[model samples]
Target: MMLPSKTVLVFSLFLLLNGILPSTTVAAARTTIGFTYSAVPSNSPSPEHVVAALQSLNIPAVRLLNPSPTLIRAFSYSNISLLLTVPNHLVTSFADNRSSATLWLYNNVLPFHPRARISLISVGADVITAAGDSGSDPTTAIVTAMQNLHHALIDLGIRTVSVSTTFSFINVITTAFPPSSAEFQEPVNSLVIKPVLEFLEETNSSLLMNVYPYNVYKLHGEIPISFALFEEGPFNFRDDVVTGVRYHNLFDMMVDSVIAAMAVSGYENVPLILTETGWPSNDEHMNVEESKMYAERYLQGLISHLKSGLGTPLRKEGAAETYIYQLFDDENESNSRRNNSLISDGDTMQQHWGVMYNNLTMKYNIHFDNADQISTVLGLLVPSMYFLWLLYDFRLAGILLVLVYFHSRKSEGLDTKITFITCQIFTSRFISGLLIDIDDYFCAFGAAKTHVSRSAFLVSTMLIFSVA
Candidate 1:
């Protein structure tokens, strides 16, 4: 059954507009997706091999958990940005002494800086957990350490590497149920996060966080598993009663919780970076939730959602950069080092969080690039072009050109003249069709009232009849 021409035209216009508007209107900066590489000295692959793998995967950025000069040097000229981290154990020492920060930078950063593309320096990862393990409060020392590091970079004339510390979402956010009602936990909020945020704002650095939807789901069983997994369905949503904003996924809620907390702290404009986020493919106890399938689903969904350029509900720009947990599972490392700072919900089970094996092979089939953006462009463009071809019937134009060329070929020295005549003919047909189509469309709406002027209609009809 053939649809009405007007209906077909409206459908074509809908597809064209839907396809063109998304690509053009939403000009938000693309969120960069990267991986975290934590090296275990005994069993890890060579830095060169890792760099090669990252380049092959088209990974634009990487966060080094235990950054070595060798590993830093491997990324020199690789064109990949490095987010180098300082061990949590050294936070207090660096905070107490400025020389210590400078010396650390000399060993890790100075030799292969711009070449290595060292973008951000994470002063420490989850210092709260480390401080508790050490039986003291070194959380405040984190800001001091960051300040010292920033000064050290300045002293060395290195201003490109921004300084900040990483915080675990579970450790900081007081309430995760309603994101808008969330706020940073006590003492630390005032003593640590607020001060750190101020320093970050001053230096124009982003707040680093390790947010895991798995942890949130585990802690709060009432929340559906699909929400944490980034599954989209009509019922897969939660309403924030206070703010009246609906949340589709748990990750966005967790992120917006942080954003809301920051707004409360008076540094809402500061950028955010996810230093660690991923699901474990396996657990020591063989738990149902911790499997390869769930892991793949979570990572794939997270990547696609971020690449959509639709940031979290609170922050339109979303995370500036998000690094997937670990590249290779470090089986050789002790359980303490493995789950060092990511302890959440009183569950510190040794989990396999690596996307790749120690043999440097990926466990899951994943595309690290934003191929979805390319697919979106092609998806919209192909249909739009098809609709355009249908609307204009360019097949006739092609046939006309062929006939004109063949007929003119018989007459010597009429090539240019025939080409000009063919263009004129095509232009007249296009204009006549356009004007008549407009008149017909409006006539359909007005029941025989023509929108195009009568004189213009006469001219177009005369040209069409003459051509025929």
Candidate 2:
């Protein structure tokens, strides 16, 4: 279907803004959804009020992209899980000096861990990714900073906090179709992706992927909107001949693309966590009704999908732990049109990527409790000793292991599930080169059998062990 013309689109926008149109979303099962909390002025809510607001809204977790003690303090004593960030520009200094990392933690996270629910420390932003940040490959800087800061966290006895970094999906994925055929491009794959995956594997950390299906639909109009929205799609299904997995939504495809890329790169069991994903809205670009519909449908669908515990088509046992792109809009950033280089729609959207207005008013319709309340056990991951290498905290992984172990045992017999999950997902050579008894694990498995069943056990095993 061709997109609506400018006239109709404009009229629609007008009506929605005038409140003639309403934003509506279907009910969906709850999932763990957080939002990006950009810094606001001190006393804007006096920190205490902001924390109260977040709790009252039932926000499960929050990712603070910018370093804001005030915001962190606001979340302190609140139940919300906090994912703090390290600026990209600081990657160099943090990587170079252990003291720099320590100092950062002392200020940002030391005073607040269990109290603030400091869950993860993202190493850097994607802003510096395009040119490698300050002339050095920012990915490398990220790796180093993550390693050192992890040590700092450990030294500080902050065991619950994991270290990770964000990567743009477009930067890593080379092909997305047919799902199974996905792989990462060179230089990025070898230089960035491979190392990053290895670091995550060793650390028992997830590759924080920032995916924007909204951008995909906007840029590639041929793709169905439902594909991006996580809603029941117009296509409904796309099959991968090799994987034999049928994809119902664009999110699983995009996510599994990274999984496939990791599998191809010899690190089959690398885990994933979503650091950013959301739709945008603005009066000039789209109407309030349209904007509300975008958030409602997309989020409701995503919440239901995640809570289904079906995982993705490819990794049935793995769940996506996702954080929404933003809470409230940033006025200054939104207003900056970059000298009017962007077209009308793009300009409108540029400043309007928020669930609420910067003034803390709801821009669209959504229930805070449904989007928050983070403990949604949608899927369990297979264990890998190597995957668990750098992570000293094994409680979370241990729980998943037990759940998946029992789940597997109840179904396809223990031997096959554990063996396949561990070895099949591993690269051919890695499996071909394991120290254990291969036949005892594989039995008389025919080529006809699919390989996802036992991957959990093996990945968990790798996660437990540290690789040199």
Best by TM-score: 1
| Per-candidate TM-score against the hidden true structure | 0.74, 0.67
Count of backbone collisions within predicted model 1:
0
- Candidate 2 Cα outliers beyond 4 Å, as residue runs: 1-31, 40-46, 127-136, 284-290, 334-349, 368-468
Predicted candidate 2 versus true structure: per-residue lDDT over 1-468, tens digit per residue: 222342343334333322421212112223466787776534233556556667777678888888666568777678888888887678788889988999988888877666788888888766335344336666566677788998988898878888888777665677677668888887777766677778889888877877766655665556777777776745866788887887888888887887888788888776677877776665534444237577667776776667554677667644446887676666555322221112345455354566765456666666544423432221111123223321322343344346545656666544443434433223222332231213222321212223343364456435423220
Write down the lDDT of every candidate, Cα atoms only.
Answer: 0.78, 0.62
Off by over 4 Å in 1: 1-24, 283-285, 332-348, 373-468
How does model 2 score by TM-score? 0.67
Question: In lDDT terms, how accurate is model 2?
Answer: 0.62
**Each prediction's number of clashing residue pairs:** 0, 28
Once model 2 is optimally superposed onto the true structure by TM-score, how far is the C-alpha of residue 76 displaced, in angstroms?
2.0
User: How close is each model in CA RMSD to the real structure?
Assistant: 12.6, 20.1
